[model samples]
Target: MTNTKKETRTVNIDIRKDLFGANENAAALNAETFKKHGIVAIDIMGSVGTGKTQLIETLCDHLRDKYRILMLAGDLATTIDADRVASHGVDTVQINTGTACHLDARMVRVALQNVNLADYQVIFIENVGNLICPAGYSLGVDRKLVVVSITEGPYMIRKHPLTIKHADMVIINKIDLVEALEFDIDALEADIREVDAAIPVLRVSSKTGEGIDQLIKVLNL
Candidate 1:
């Protein structure tokens, strides 16, 4: 009798599933860490040139006196956004994602590893500039704010409904240029309402500081 050796096969693993599962686990840990420290972490997500950095700067300027703020800026490269926030007297850490499209929970956890979380009362994570990818990953934040600007054109809200669905609040930024751009502010807001009627939508102009106070009040900061 000839003995035949059993053949071994390598099973194909779904990397995306594994990746998201790992991210969720890490995010839970991050949430626990933030809660223990009494830190309110906000993840700011939006497309490029949506004025995310400026909004953070505006928020920092408004809350710095009342809270110790730490901003984590994520990008493909460079510390430009982090530097901008740092100039506002806010402590910042830049997470250069290289080729990664978004900031994941592991990245945030690793970024804050060296820092003392107890020193900060709030953490604003400016996610990588992309509406699609950032919304898929959770950075273990208390709130996720999506900044959509009139400069991005009318289709932004309709094209990226998932981002809006995932966000706790939708900020219509750069409203100061609404008339100049002939952009329909009410229509854009209506589109957002279509996505998630209950989600809070706020019009803000980080440039002129319009609605900043209202935003602060809404955030309870």
Candidate 2:
């Protein structure tokens, strides 16, 4: 005798849009905070072993005298990067993201909660070692630098166009090993240019201090 039809209900959720929207809002707030404190924040993004930490260490060593610097290291579980930068005598805040692959705006805000923003003029946020996830989130930084190493093979630039597109600067690190590795730096630059016509590309060898000054100039640091 149960002849009544069950009510039909459907709910559509635009997860990507919603998630990014929330992140954008948080990012805006973060931007305002940085602006208010007069801090120059830079987001460093790249895959593992791309020498991101070393680059930050080099930058800290170079800019420490000119500006008070702070580093925020994002990782899945370890504080290795933070410790490395800290060894350079720069203050650091290690953000262990647990299972999260990327650092979101909210995470940055929370990390900076107790930080004395006025005590520092420059902040480097070393994003989680990932090419994909980090690009999807903004941590309210002045610039996003994606570090790609010559040792990571030639196809990395070709495979991650979106990441390059989002980057303010593309740093081809470990240039000192180019001769030994026989890597085609020109071809990789061309690939990046294909993705972004006018994006600034820099060749750097953090270990050897090669091109580090040029990078600093380009960054206006």
Candidate 2's residue-wise lDDT over 143-201, tens digit each? 99999999889999788888887889999999999999999999999999999999999
Q: RMSD to native for every prediction?
A: 1.3, 2.1
User: Cα RMSD for candidate 1?
Assistant: 1.3
* Candidate 1 stretches greater than 4 Å from native: 2-12
Per-residue error at 83 for model 2, in Å? 0.7
Candidate number with greatest lDDT: 1
lDDT to native, each model: 0.95, 0.94
